[model samples]
Target: MAGIKQVRNRKLLPDLRKEGHLSKEIVLSTTEKHGVPAGSRLFSHHTLASVRKLSFYHPFSIPEDSLDIILAATYDHSYEHFADKEDLYLQPETRGCETWRRLRNTVGKPPKPKIPLGHPMKRGGITERKSPFSVKLMNSGVHSSQTNPGYSRQPAGGAIFFY
Candidate 1:
């Protein structure tokens, strides 16, 4: 929270780094992926206000139970609002070009890798962090004769099936 004071004073870089109070970033990223659920306490006014102030990028307004439509509207509104504030309307040449460049750079390409976290690796070069390539098993949808549409049930032999 001390860093919030630093940010408010403009002492810290306005650009967001990976570390910090990541709740806003987590919510935004997750909303983009899984969508926001209704009555999410995470979007309560007090929490959202703090997120608005601290977040580097403008957080898009997420609609309850509707992701695509809300995302589109939020995108359009953000573009128009920022365009007006940056005076892209009055000054077409300089202002518009600058705005375009900044926006392009921000959204254009993938960022290069930064330093990895945690201590140096041991002899085998393995760390405690989870690897992306790890193998895993997932539940497959299979139906049993006794089950209904998309319904799963434990069979007599402890096998699960979908109907």
Candidate 2:
């Protein structure tokens, strides 16, 4: 955690430390695939204070729990949230008979291979990391399960996930 700097003056999630575990603020990439529990509560907000404090993107409270379990919301759901919603997935425009897109399909499309680098912005430096394509997102109906994180039994599933 050498280069990590905790954000100050921000309200943490309620009951952040009922147990001994700590909470972290996560930022996922647009091309990444993360899971949220089927019915887990998902929310968004931009407070005057928070907006002022954060420079890049307002904090996205990706739950370490409520959204920990597995779900069936796995459509072509990009890690598409705010902020990069525009830069990563810009819309097309038409002028008279000409229709042009700000991006080319190959800019970030198939046939073009994606390299497996660790989460670059994560606090610690990157080590050779394994792909989480097999993590078992356990079924649950509550926040942080009595079970470990959705990643305990890591290499359990397959690449083709079904709803």
Candidate 3:
């Protein structure tokens, strides 16, 4: 039950430049906990360079026996929503583990069948072709090598133009 801090038009630091993976916005002068019940704001900078240097991962250290956060949402519905809803911060076993790796030594191994198109059925499927038209190039070969009367390519290895 702390006061919220209002931040506006603040510049975010780049990601790669930071040491950790996730770099959330700094909660300046706010008594709010990170990922509080109320939704938090994510910011972006004009330059891609600034974003590249920012961190994308949260730094919360997971206890050796605990799971990691899969989903984080802020909600106001208390009572049932708070009791029945699953906590996004809880990481269940096999959450981040590869499914195939976990099933490696399991029993009742079903024979892997060759999917009609590919191993993953979703990606392999025949689709109707729309265009029956024979492809034709509008431009045949090169136009007259006529150099523009006004402009021409600089002599080979010409002076380098610097910004």
Who wins the TM-score comparison?
3
Query: TM-scores for all candidates?
Result: 0.16, 0.11, 0.17
For residues 66-130, could you state the per-residue lDDT of candidate 1 as single tens digits?
44433333234445654443232232223333221121112223354454765543577555788
* Tens-digit lDDT string for candidate 2 (1-163): 2333223322322222211232435332222123644233233322343333444433333325423312212223466455433343222222112122211111112243344684435567776776765454566446544444443333466343333
Candidate 3 Cα misplacement greater than 4 A, ranges: 12-67, 70-163
The segments of candidate 1 whose C-alpha lies over 4 angstroms from its true place after superposition are: 1-35, 39-52, 55-94, 99-106, 109-163
Better of 1 and 2 by lDDT: 1
Residue pairs whose backbone atoms clash in candidate 3: 14-53, 14-54, 15-53, 15-54, 15-55, 16-53, 21-57, 22-56, 22-57, 23-55
**What lDDT does model 2 reach?**
0.33
| Predicted candidate 2, C-alpha RMSD | 29.9
